[model samples]
Target: MAWGESGELFAINGDDLLTLSLEDQTVETRASDLKKDSPQHLPFSGANILFDIAVGPDGTAFVAYYGNRQLLAVSPAGVVSVLVQSESPWSPHGVDVWGDYVYFLESTVGGRPRWKFWGKDRIAPRVRRVSVGTSTLETIYDGL
Candidate 1:
């Protein structure tokens, strides 16, 4: 979960994004069924999980999807759009914003069963940083 600029907290559940208002102690849907809402007509089929969220300074939400290898944005107005997506096996997880960049982690071993048993040398996980507006991705670290 991540907190917005206005102090609203956002979270991803299954394939849905929800908001919690601390003042009112209420929960509401920010975006529903990401598969249907994903950009480029790429419907999120199967048990695709909406993994993590990062709320921008303007109250927009950035979400990471492990199965889809995608990063998505939810405007404060609740418009959902894909910020980044790939056909490769770059399974993205754990997202957050720092200044002008959105940072996330990736593991090639992801989406595979019993990945925990895989050798570290075989599974090269990475940390990536990207521009929020331009979506220019950079690999900051790999493995360990």
Candidate 2:
């Protein structure tokens, strides 16, 4: 769960992105199933297992999609987009947004069936960040 600067609380339940208005005390589903941003018509892969959520200053919600290893962005109007993608065994684990970038964590599943483990997939853990405005990806400490 995360609180947006616009006074809305954002959360992910299953495949549904929910937004709760603190003022009016109303809850709304921003996006569901995340089908709009899916890669293909996958049977098992299409199921989105949302992990963490972060709301930007402009009310855009960033989510860590664990199932298919994707970081998604949901607009204030509930439009969804696949912001960043990771390869198999390496899934997006955590997410947060600050000023000009959306911070995220990508970790390996290590062949876990139910997305249970966070072991390295024979790869060293690295650090990176994506710029919000220009959408440029800058690597900080990529095993360098």
Candidate 3:
């Protein structure tokens, strides 16, 4: 869950995006079944794994899907669009935004069973930045 620039709170509930109503303690579904709306097949078997969420200043919500290796943008009207989809071995995690770039940890560790990598070194962890405006992705740091 993450707070938007306008102080609106957003959260993912079982692969669905919901906006929390703090004033009345209500929740509104912004988007549902994200995997069904994805542009490409999300390479995963069980439930969808939504890693992180970040909201931009313009009220666009960013959702990081570990299983799909894609970062999608949900507009205020709940229009879903693929912002950046990594080719392979690079899934977006810990998504956040500052200035014009959305920052995240791009790693291959995602989609792997947690027990296998528990208490072990991550595989090729990287820091990446994507332009929120142009949707251009760039590697800020790679490897150790």
Candidate 4:
């Protein structure tokens, strides 16, 4: 769970994104029904597993969608939108917001089902960040 700068606490429960109030202790749904039904265009199949959430300065939550290999933004009013999506085989995870960028971790594999225990050295993990309002990604660290 992560506490937003705007006093809201964010967490991922199953496929749902939940926000909680510290003062009133109220819980609200930010997003839900995150699972995918059919394999259409994206590299992965099955349900969308939300990995991590980062609350932006404007109180919007930037979520790392592992199954879809994309970043999603949840507004303060609970509107969900895709921030960016990668056509590659990487799956995004571990998100945080700092300064002008939203930093996250990406696995070389697409999803958990496709993951293997050995021969993973060739599949390098990366620490990447994207500028707000742009889909352009910048690598902070690679081969980690």
Candidate 5:
């Protein structure tokens, strides 16, 4: 979640988007349930699992969804719209706004197993970046 103009808190549920009034602690729906009816299939399949949000210079809030690598833009009026979609199974985990760019991190794996018997890395396997306005994506970094 992130703060909007004047410190208004906003959150994305991956299924429904919402905004909160910090003064009164009121909750409002920004975007309702989104249905993916696309016939063209993708490797990833699931509702949005929004993990982080960042407000841009224009006061627009961008939400990063970990499940489908979907980024959503929330307008001042609480309207949520699709900003970008990863071409593969990349999971978005964190987000922040840097000047004219909305920067975010996408991971290849969700999380690491706790026990040694699982034999999994205790962190995300990989990450990438994308330009907010232009929708240009690039692999900035990666690791196991």
Candidate 6:
């Protein structure tokens, strides 16, 4: 859950990416399962398992999904659409939006553990950033 404009609390349910309006205490889903009827060849199978949601500076909400690794933008009028999707596994845990950029944490397979049973070497993690109005995604940091 995070704060929206005017300091209103917005909660995102983990199951269906529902955005609840705490101001009026009403439950409303931001995205729908429109891709459920799509063929298997399609990337989004309509199974939306949301992980995190971040409100941009303009009050637009950005939601990340774990099922399809897709990011969506929700407007104040309740329109939802895909923002970006590629080969990257965007298992976003947390999200924040800055000026013209949306920053988030994406889980990548760093490497296999050195030890099998009691591994001590921690594999480095990666951070990803996507432009708000562009399709380019760049890795800001790695080996974390």
lDDT of 3 by residue, 1-144 (tens): 999866679998887999997878888998988765453535445424788999989988988887777888899999998888777656776789899998887666554443234466345577888898787879998763
lDDT tens per residue, model 6, 2-116:
6676554556654444556666887766555523333222323443456678888667787765556566677766677777663543345457787888887655334545222
Error of 6 at 101 (Å): 1.0
State the lDDT of candidate 1 residue by residue for 1-144, as single tens digits.
988888898877766789999999999998888754444423234426677888889888988877678888898878988777744556677789999998887766444342463354244477888898788988898664
3 or 6: which has the higher TM-score?
Answer: 3
Q: Which residue segments of model 1 deviate by more than 4 Å?
A: 36-47, 110-122
Task: Tally clashes: model 2.
Answer: 0
Per-residue CA lDDT of candidate 2, range 22-122, in tens?
89999999998863466442214444567789888888899887676678899988888888876554566578886799888766433334333334424
Query: How much lDDT does each candidate structure score?
Result: 0.75, 0.72, 0.78, 0.76, 0.64, 0.60
If ranked by lDDT, best first, what sequence of candidates would result?
3, 4, 1, 2, 5, 6
Full ranking by TM-score:
3, 4, 1, 2, 5, 6
Best candidate (score: TM-score): 3
Clashes of each: 1, 0, 0, 0, 1, 0
Instruction: Specify the highest-lDDT model's number.
Output: 3
**lDDT score of residue 7 within candidate 3:** 66
- Candidate 3, lDDT over the whole model: 0.78
Cα lDDT of model 4 by residue, 55-96, tens digit: 989888988887787888888888888787755766787899
Q: What's model 1's lDDT at 66?
A: 72
Candidate 5, pairs of clashing residues = 14-48
Model 3: weakest 10-residue lDDT segment is 109-118
Q: Which stretches of candidate 2 lie over 4 Å from their true place?
A: 35-48, 110-124, 142-144
Native-to-model Cα distance after best TM-score fit, residue 90 in candidate 2, in Å: 1.9
| 10 residues in a row with least lDDT, candidate 5 | 34-43
In candidate 5, which residue ranges exceed 4 Å CA deviation?
A: 34-48, 110-125
